[model samples]
Target: MTEQRLRALVYGDVDLNLIDGSAIWAQSMVRALRAAGCRVTLVLKAPVRTGRLVDPLTELDGVLVRHPHAEGLVDGDAPMTVPQAHAVLGRVDGDHPHDLVVVRGRAIAAALAGDGAFRNRLWPYLTDVPQNLAGFTPEIHGDLRRIARAARTLLCQTEELRCFLEQTVPEACGKSVLFPPTVVVPPELADPAPRTANTPLRLVYTGKFALRWNTFEMTGLPTRLTNAGVPAELDMVGDKIHDERDDPDFADRMRRALESAPGVHWHGGHPREKAMAIAAGADIGLSWRAPELDASLELSTKVLEFGALGLPVLLNRTPMHETLLGEDYPLFAASEDDAVDALRRAAQNPDLYALAAARCRAAADGFTLERAAERLRAALAEVYPQPSVAVAGPPLKVVVCGHDLKFFTRLLQHLAALPGLDVRVDPWRTLSEHDEERSRELAAWADVVICEWCGPNALWYARHKKARQRLIVRLHRFELESGWPQKLDIDRVDQVVCVSPHYAALTAEATGWPTEKITVVPNWVDVAQLDRPKLPGARFHLGFIGAAPSRKRLDLAVDVVEELRRRDPRFTLFVKSKLPWEYWWIWKRPEERAHYEALFRRIAASPSLAEGVVFDGYGGDVAAWLRRVGFVLSTSDDESFHLAPAEGMASGAVPVVRNWPGADTIYDRRWIHRDAGEMADAIEVIVKGGRWDEERRIGQGQVRDGYGLPRVRDAWEEIVRGR
Candidate 1:
């Protein structure tokens, strides 16, 4: 095993047998946490019947699902209610408690947040949180404060909710992390491009068939739109119908309408994926909720699912929706009349569906399964911090040999501080050669030797290392193309680490090493140290960290800044990197010198870029420097794993990356741009609009989820310990 598997206990108060949103959320939460490398033990709040939803979760490795009734927590099929479940919390905790306890109910969270056993390992995510000043009573504030102060993180479903929590409960200021409405996107969309408007425009709604969901009004769409000369139909998929005392006939009216309506179809109920497929088959998605929910800050999961399937959604024109889909979104509806009118208008102009689809696609990209996994991964990192080692026996001697340890410095320090080992370094003079006497002395004394780079240092160790020693090699971007990996005797090395999967495969092909022998561990970013509050004037400031040797594309950044300033003169570009002259290898080439010189001339020649472009001196205090940056740019032609932008994101700056290969996999696709113009366009929308605060906060969580130091540090230590 690799050190120790991350242990997590997830308790969501919902019946997993149903297709409700809360039920689906529990299922998706389990999947996301498992994807983040957790060995989860999920406890159900209610008894299972068909166990349909639990099937998918059981298929996942390192996941254990526990039923409340089967465990005797409840008498029979009766639910283990909040208080009932709270009594058995210790039983679920076991002898050695799970590293993280995720409680989903507000009352249960308040009950367990300050418990001695849970300590700082409890992560509480409540949907019933008060949203405004009117809702935040003194008693409620006290309850929220107790939970926030004791819990590791207060998970929020929307930025608006997070802001409200911070304002209403002061203790939740730094503890809140956005866990936005998560959706499972189809691997390939049913339709990539929008189809021209046609007759029988199909609209689909999936979830509870409730009055507030406006499903009853949706049945009238076909009649109203057909009379308006645009034929339409409605597909309603769900089984749950609440019995309201105030509105006793709501369900009966819905059933009679479905049975008698000309074009409305009712699918009883289906699993999440099946329901989504049904929605994907339709022309438009119905998410037009009642006016009562408009003041709520939570984002709609159904809207995200519809968008994930590439369907245009009909939603209420609330502030939350406006910020997500933009104010110009064509399908904003407030009532049944507004919805019918919007559909009629869209049918007349097919281009509106195309625009709506684009907007929906953009907004949904940030709430995907991958993004959810990343967010969960980051949240878990806080609960399981890197531990300072305590020696149990004779220290195991370990040494790191490399010419450049700049990238390995943080990791090296982590190992050196561990109490179990006597750590040392054998710094090589160059890539291929080392001081033979010093290297030999270290090799004899070391039980584990780590080659920081796949250069001569690794090759030499591969040929001469003792049989009992465990030698590990780490390969980077340059080593793959430089032919150094092919020279190493890979059989001698215990493991070869690569920064990414793309490079890992390339290294395997180059070395003919066994596929199982290689692992992809991303470079670590110190998220805890880097994440800080943004400066006051940072809204207009753009930052680019390494613009050197022409490939980093200083010219392209200048072009983007020029376009941005033309639209808004408040935009500025701050370039933080060493000048080209500082690198002798780059300056020795005349083309490199000419490229940088020309870029400098262009920036000075342009009226907009003259004062707008600032070149700050390079320094190690990047976290401190990133305070004044609002946006971080990656305009390079290519990259293996760009830590600069991840570092920027860790420091609460939005990332604006060029669509390099696999760029979307590393970060959210919403941040990746096709060209300099698109990058500028995206940035302008944030600065000129009201989404900067929310956008940067999400970025901060995204980067930590991807490459935070603790997760990577754990992976590296396992390789070193040969576990």
Candidate 2:
């Protein structure tokens, strides 16, 4: 592949300064694309501000650079608006379709989605993901949905980020590919300098100096190593300083550390090559960051750079890092003390240093330019064969007729927007009835009729459905016991959808429905909408949806919280739901009122319970509301799907489920408890034993993979399309 071939593909990024990690990635990936046998239309976010940093990749083989000739509005000076960047994309790909167009930035991704030009060939390489609960707002959620809806594939920088993305935006679940950071090893560093005895153990850090980067703490390394009987020196090569917003003196302190700390040399800043040259001479790289950054799903590019130069990296022992360097890697550190011990041990032992270096080299092998090129090439090629086909034929006539389309709306919207499907909704007036005139009109018009609930609407469709029209009726928990399924004519319906396998089995047994006709499609949790990082001290906050209607067993959840607070008053329960009095039907019932009255009296009697139990009323922002909850309690008497636990799991909360009928089938056996006491036992063990975060991730993985909207949508689509 030569420079001529690069024109078939395009690469666009939002950053124009070409400095940060994202810029570094662009430089590396462009080279990988060149090697992958595709010439590219390199679209810059802004016009080249100077000749000094005009990316050399623009002049590479098979490359065409598109600079915004019309002076676009520059942000302050360097960055261009997303509109200008998008305009560049439009100009380059006008009418004539390219093989692929890779873009970046959430804003530009949104723009590309709205432009509707590169519908099928767009690959968005994303970074700067939301790190907190408040970040995944409704607007942000819509932006992600648009991106997912537009792109053929999404590229993530790390596996962890991809997992988070899937949970955050389920539509991107199967489409996302790992496009991890790549390293360009300098040829001059082909052979790493030997760390011989009597020579100072050189520790180098190359990046922006920041509190979270632990650059200030890095200055203390040389002296601490010297105190341990091994003389050391520190080299830092970055000019940018990230000041903590709340800490005005942080930069001053960092400057003092770099200037006055013993045996420390600082190179203000240099080009990538110049910086790598300094790092090449070092024996080890310093990347042990602060605890705050440990929660990040991104991989450290510094580690890859160091490893590319055959140097071991001293970094935090995060799961991603551990997987990269293994459990036995000598340089993994958790605290300042661990860092001192690890560095001292590596300095004293040549064998351990050599081992870490070798392991680091091996870990970095898969991230080289050659490997990345191969992966990128294959990903592009895979997409090329299955080109986006426009909605060609007559739209598949679909009518989703039901009273409660709450669960069906997400699927309906997807179907309505699909290329080949013409979808409509014929909502029933109530659970068992619809307007006779409108219902008759819809039934005749639809090629496919979906009765969302197996209620009266389904019963009517089962008898009246045309032989040619495909009728799909879904059975829920209430219908199985309400005699609706038994009343319907079984042979007319093409498919019977159940939310869970346990319910499907019960439906088959109790209603005598044919086993072969029923299929289980679990209720979806809008993972991306629900899943966000937990709030501060969420581990101590237990939560449940509501206490109303009695069967939900809100009192049992209070019991668990009361039990936990007995041992540790720090534990608290947040009830984010309407009370019995809020619902007239529930409040009017003498039995329901009595149950809540007794429960309130008990809570008022105990000081711990009074303080620990809090009723945080219903909020439309379920996604953000879940952030305050660490342990989601599901102590219901019985349920078909019990959506709360799944939503909680998606939101990075550990679930404590009562062993209601089929609860084990819906959730992992570990989360299901026999009683309130056992639920409290599980919560205490997960929290006190320091496995809450781990459990949180596991829960997210489970929900994201199994019950995410994409999975459920696919299952429903297959049945609807007769695939």
Q: Please report the candidate that would top TM-score against the real structure.
A: 2
Q: What are the lDDT scores of the predictions, listed in order?
A: 0.82, 0.80
Best by lDDT: 1
| lDDT per residue as tens, model 2, 616-682 | 7564456667877898999999899989989999989998999999988889998888999999989
RMSD of each: 14.2, 7.9
| TM-score of model number 1 | 0.58
Task: Give per-model TM-scores.
Answer: 0.58, 0.64
Q: Write the per-residue lDDT of candidate 1 for residues 256-341, one digit (tens) a residue.
A: 88777878898877877778878888888989989988988888898988888888899999878987898899999998899999
As for candidate 1, its clashing pairs are none
Model 1 alpha-carbon drift over 4 Å, by segment: 186-197, 387-723
Least well predicted 10-residue stretch by lDDT in candidate 2 = 382-391
